[model samples]
Target: MKRIYLSLSLLLLVIIGSRAANFKFAFLTDIHITAGDSIPYNDLARSVNQINDTPGIEFAIVSGDITNIGDRQSMEVVKSLLDRLNVEYHIIPGNHETKWSESGVTDFARVFGSERFKFEHDGILFMGVNSGPIIRMADGHVAPQDIDWIKTELDKAGKEKPVIFITHYPLQPGDVDNWYDVTDAIRPYNIRLVMGGHYHKYMQLEYDGIPGILCRSNLRAKEKTGGYSLCEVTPDSIFIYEHKIGNVPTRKGAYSMTGMNYPKSNAGYPRPDYSVNKEFPQVSEQWLVRSGYEIFSSPAYWDKKVYVGDDSGAISCYSATDGRKQWSFKSDMRIIGTPAADKNVVVFGSADMNIYGLNASDGRLLWKINTEAPVLGAVTIRNGIAYIGGSDHKFRAIDIKSGTVVWSYDGVEGYIETKPLVYDNLVIFGAWDKNLYALDKKTGKEVWKWHEGKPGRFYSAAAVWPVAANGKVFIADPERVLTAIDASTGKTVWRTKESMVRETVGLSEDKRRIYSKTMNDSVVCYSTTTDFPEKIWASNVGFGYEHAPSMPVEKEGVVFGSTKNGLMFGLDAHTGKVLWKHKVGNSLISTLVPLSKNKCLFTATGGEIGLLVIDYKINKHK
Candidate 1:
């Protein structure tokens, strides 16, 4: 009687599992809706209508890149269109929405109800979370908090339930900085497949033996009409098809999910190569610390201490000689801007909509000034005043001691992110409104404002920290053009794309040369005294196809710069000759602080803070 009862129970389980796996869903991505762009808007609308009209589709998943510029207006348009779908939908933000976000990435949650989603349907658990570089240009990263959430959700699903993971970028080294952190977490679970939508094409991929799928964009690129994909799941296999607007569905691929192995080992997968550190035996890390959180800003130095902030809203102070934590203070939100220190006080801004001043010694809160919106701009200190900008369209000068607003400039048209260049009685900074403004530092009055000819904020002079010398201000914008403006008149001295420089510019200590990194593998120098861009020298450093906004710093005749892929290098300040290149990690390196010609302190987006030092023997021989 017991054997007969057990056989009947096994049969019942098989019937329920087969019924649960049989379902169909729609997969749409990269709609890229702009405010006045009728093509993409119309394409997304047609796709929504088609999904509503389809009979067997149960639900839909829109994986990221919902807006073109990540503004409030464009996100609203996307929301209205997605709301018209007949089936329930889940969505996440892509790089386009997070990198250029006008609200410091807060508006996405307000419009979409959340930045992540998870739901169970027909006994299968589906989960999605955001992978972002935040308001800075770097590689995609899964936030520490979000990683914890992913582990919790996957654990609750247990090792016997089928799970599908969703994200914007592929789980690879170049696409996501901490891809291993995610793949390792899900590898232990009964993962069925991974889905993403960054490359805007349909492709089959494998990440350490796990099946992955990349979806196409909804925008009609070179085609008459745009479309999305249809996914069908069965008891033992899953099939994907491309459904063009007004056309029949074409089968893309099919893969079996049953009898697969879980918890794959990381034996053969390619990881970030740190062998470059072995090649450059002269350079080594003096001290290193891992915060386990994404760090977007650079490190600021005070009296014998290094101060840095991370995405967790914590500001920490460490000893300069040895990387030991001295103290830390926490805020209510993330800190995406670099802090400025002067007169024993450290000041920084947070997405919590507050600017804080803390004691340099103990990390005690001196004071905080609230703003109407998130403060994403770096701080600049000049003669006891802290100059910073916020998304509220205001630039302020605050007293370091009293925590009171000394003056406010309310004419900024867009949010500011670069540090103000306090040079020659003027505070110079760039905004997302395609303009750079110079204000009188003493009176808080506008000195001059210069606008780029480009139409969109993507090409605006907003990311690079402006450098000034020889009666001119030098800036590099995203349009691959370097401009030299007259310091006093706000007129263009010369604008040139001859070198093809992006948003990374630095000035020499002697104030005779300006250094910049090109879009390809070269570092070029320009004479500050020349009327036009005069190339001093160009060195091929072998950092291929780099586009990070981290500025170079020169100290004691050694020029130090970092790349988007965790490479920190030094060059001869005069000849542009590569001195040494070290691979610190596999993420974007923030701006470096050169303590001396032999040692430098650096931070990266992947939560690594370390001190790079030349070996004592090598320095002695030199």
Candidate 2:
């Protein structure tokens, strides 16, 4: 079911090329076309056409899973359709396209590889890996033999040139796997960028000093709109573009656990230092008369309404102009994550370990299916099912309509603090066990896992920076440091060093650069680089913070967030100079939530949550 959208941003992508012609091509992945599905096919066609709308383009790359069924007929259909793109297309096969035969990938390799073959375009070497073994299913071996070939090719190539690796599988888990030997082989190279697909959603990570970008596909992207990632590569840095298709409205719901005391296991029992005292508000004038909980999760504003989630485990739809509730739906558990909504049904996950598909018109629950674990993170749905990561230490896909479990990976044992993102055909998420996992969306099999020397543990979900432009994954560890990982192989592209952080929310960004804020009482910005760890600027916004400041927000030219001491701050996004500061009575733990260009929301420990209005007309424009 689809809903009409009030399209906001134009379909055109905004990309900035390198001044030296060092910029290379852009890519997309997981455009699932089942031959006959006109919706997805039209979306893909329109997306490619839009991509062509932007230029300086060297070539086009697709990570994998071009076809839904991997049938000879379907492959032909996708190829013929993609052929109309009016640009050079590089291809990779995902697990879905390789599910048919042992030599299924060989067929894809024969058909798509004629054009998809690895090569150095614009002085950067690009390699392609099929999502599954090109041979067969059970006999499907992730090609270890290819590792030496990449090394040999690079050895023959110049080390000074920035090498970009592309494939369907990521060298990282929550990516593509069986290619660790291949990934380990290329680690010593000066490869600056790694790109992959199969996980249809967008992701960027920095692990072990390697930077990787996983793009969101043309087919099914679980965002406000179905979109594609645009990337630009210079000899030094990569820039990314998050091109949106249209604006779809969302619904509000509660994302919380039904039971108390949280999950057991010594894995994440709060330490004495991590504990804090929380106080409920008094009945005095300090308390608002409203008995209903204010929606806390990020709100998807659509159709003149605000759809957000709260702690009560319910979905609430409210008029954007006022706080009046339009509708509310109660689920079995808490809704701690954001709900992805369109006009028809709002989709979200709950601590009940279930994803609820609710009707947008009313708060009626159409379907509710259980995942492998308790979900604290949101749900990203592509095609028909929703991909979710949870405390169950599993990344799962559930049928959107019938609420049935379609597929899942239980390979790691840890709580899923991050949402499972599906780009083209890949599923990406991080765990408390110190691993980022990528898997095949079609069959629930392991693709690859990105591990960063067990960075202890993490709760902040991983964010996939836009692919192409400046692609990289930003990861945050419990010790409060953030780093970018090469998305292709789970290797570190660069590290922020422990000396630079106190806590983290991972990486947030625009197409131009990355915005990272640490708990060390400061916010810092960095761009993907070859010279390494380039700090654009750092600001000390350490005034009146109760705890380490929550994750920073990058909006316009200002980075905003509040502190535990009930103080709010806005800093120059570039200069790191303090732009604005105000105080409310609450101590904030959550990151700054933006309502519009001028408004933001924050919650504090003194039992205070306020929606603050600001004058950013000038600052937001920068």
Candidate 3:
């Protein structure tokens, strides 16, 4: 009887080990399958066969770009090839599939079941969304309906197990126009990691607070071999391995589900109730504009008029006092960046790749200049010249009066998205190329360039606007490192070891303190008065990582910050202690505009084109 009991115990151990075996699957991204493209088809066929022959791949996920064009024939070709695979598969749409395609999402859904899907495999919840707009080409947008659908899915499965999201584009703040909205929507869910494509390069990233993994294209290109990845997921940890065609697999990396500092949903990882006794600030007035579309552009205040743009391609001017609509003008595409205003004209860039000089008073277009790609950065006007950058990887100095290019600099390799800071005869801006460049304002010549280390590149480019003050240029990057560099020599003064700061750093008017929002859901105040910067204090800002912290403005020793989660905080500037917190709207993107010592204009995205008048006189945070 004792011997029989020992044998039963040993059998139970073996059963438990087999049950807890790691779940593995293949990830193929950016296949770019096209009709008549024999090379890609052949390559995909080989990959499918190899994946089938591999010992332990449960399934595969083709993370977008399955077809080069969104056509019936193209999708059918891809479907036939994928059907030959032994393992089941899933896919999402990429820019190449939707951009410039007539059928767009319809063809993809007909062939692939749905553009967005949610499924459970090996006890892990996988969610994917079509990162493409059916109408537009080459832009990342998850439809409003998808947002609601994801919320429902999260409600059902977010608390059950670790969740993984797949997108054709990385969900970083500035990669897509409205990444913050999507991030905020998912912040309340248990998202362990996000997988994306489109960059066509492997990257390990932390956006806000969630881990992001970008996969390379599976199509063999010039000087580059095709590849895919296999991820092994256990109940507690995940390990990834990269495999190139005709080569052995290499261990990519590994991470734990619960041991990470990642900001997770409260449903999955509950925290102590910080919302207790949290009193929000009062709103004097809330005005909803008739154009009830999404607004991503920061409101530009000039001549007592608030100039802003909505996703519906309308730029409107309103009275700053009562929020009365003054004049509205329509563009061919969406306006993204904040508008720059001189005395008479307001200059801004649009997604349609055009820059416009508009009459700030009457909302009339003075002139518009066409660029090679979408112009995302705000127009910086100095001495009659408008300095702006575009997705075309060129920075052009345009004549603001005539709307013509005076000079163009094509040295940068990535898209330019930051507002150009004009300082000491140089145009300073950060680009997606992972370099901070200072160019001569007049001649468009490179004055100096600086990267983080040894000219190495980060995954996504730099999109943070550089704050130049106190002889230093303060900026942040996608790598989650914030640096303060000497403005004169372009040498690093001090770099912080923190991760997940994408917005421009906030500086105290006296330049003694710097405030930044981190990926761990906290607003930290750093002391810059010393020789080396050090963290003074960090105040928790609820859950999820906010991309942009409203350039913390200080008045009467109280610092104010608006987070992307739509929560505004009034913290003691010296202690980083939360004096009060307020939920303003769906999501806050830009810094707050302090109208007076006790009042500020807070703008947000998601609902309409209007500002919330936040009066601090009566509701001062004690």
Candidate with the greatest TM-score versus the true structure: 1
Candidate 3, residues 432-458, lDDT tens digits: the string is 566789899889999889887434333
TM-score of 3: 0.62
lDDT of each: 0.89, 0.56, 0.70
Question: Candidates' TM-scores?
Answer: 0.95, 0.47, 0.62
Off by over 4 Å in 3: 1-278, 281-285, 288-290, 404-406, 454-461, 498-502, 528-531, 548-558, 617-621
Clashing pairs in 3: 99-137, 432-461
Whichever of 1 and 2 has more lDDT, that candidate is 1
lDDT value, residue 111 of candidate 1: 93
lDDT of 1 by residue, 377-403 (tens): 999998899999999999999999879
| RMSD of candidate 1 to true structure, Å | 2.3
* Each model's backbone clash number: 0, 90, 2
